[model samples]
Target: MSDIAKEIENAKRIIAEQKKRIKDAQKEAAKAESKLRDRQNYILGGALVKLAETDERAVRTIETLLKLVDRPSDRKAFEVFSRLPALSLPPQPAPDTGHE
Candidate 1:
């Protein structure tokens, strides 16, 4: 092939490789963003669970939110909530003061 034709083919190959690299980078970025969102949601869910332990309103809100789960597989994870205890913490035994 002529030198000019060889150069054109090399340029096209380089362009295709760069495009693939760009697409790969975009996919990696999207995956990272999705992971960040998952971590944030997990942290928020933990906070809500702690709040629900002592707050009736939080418990009610959680129950209401659980209703939004439409997937049967996901809904199964929430089945424990149906049998959850009251929001109040159980009474603890009195600590010994040694002054009695």
Candidate 2:
């Protein structure tokens, strides 16, 4: 083969190898993303299940306490607790000034 033709053939071979490598890398990336998504979903589902179970237990405990307490005290306790707002993650406050 002429020198120019040999060079052209070598370039084509390099391009083909590069394309194959790129395709393989893309497949591996897709597989890793799918695995990561599955793990995230499983963790989120488990957290939701745990939160529901805890909420149910809290409600049952509160009901039991109301049953055990007399009406007047139970009403008073309920009023006190009701005064508090629903619990939530509040924004973190800035550090306090040391100046008194």
Top TM-score: which candidate number?
1
Best by lDDT: 1
Point out where model 2 deviates above 4 Å.
Answer: 56-100
CA RMSD per model (angstroms):
13.3, 13.9
Alpha-carbon lDDT, every model? 0.77, 0.64
Cα displacement (Å) at residue 19, model 2? 0.6
Error of 2 at 54 (Å): 2.0
* List of clashing residue pairs for candidate 2: none
lDDT string, candidate 1, 26-74, tens digits: 9999999999999999999889888887888888887778767766567
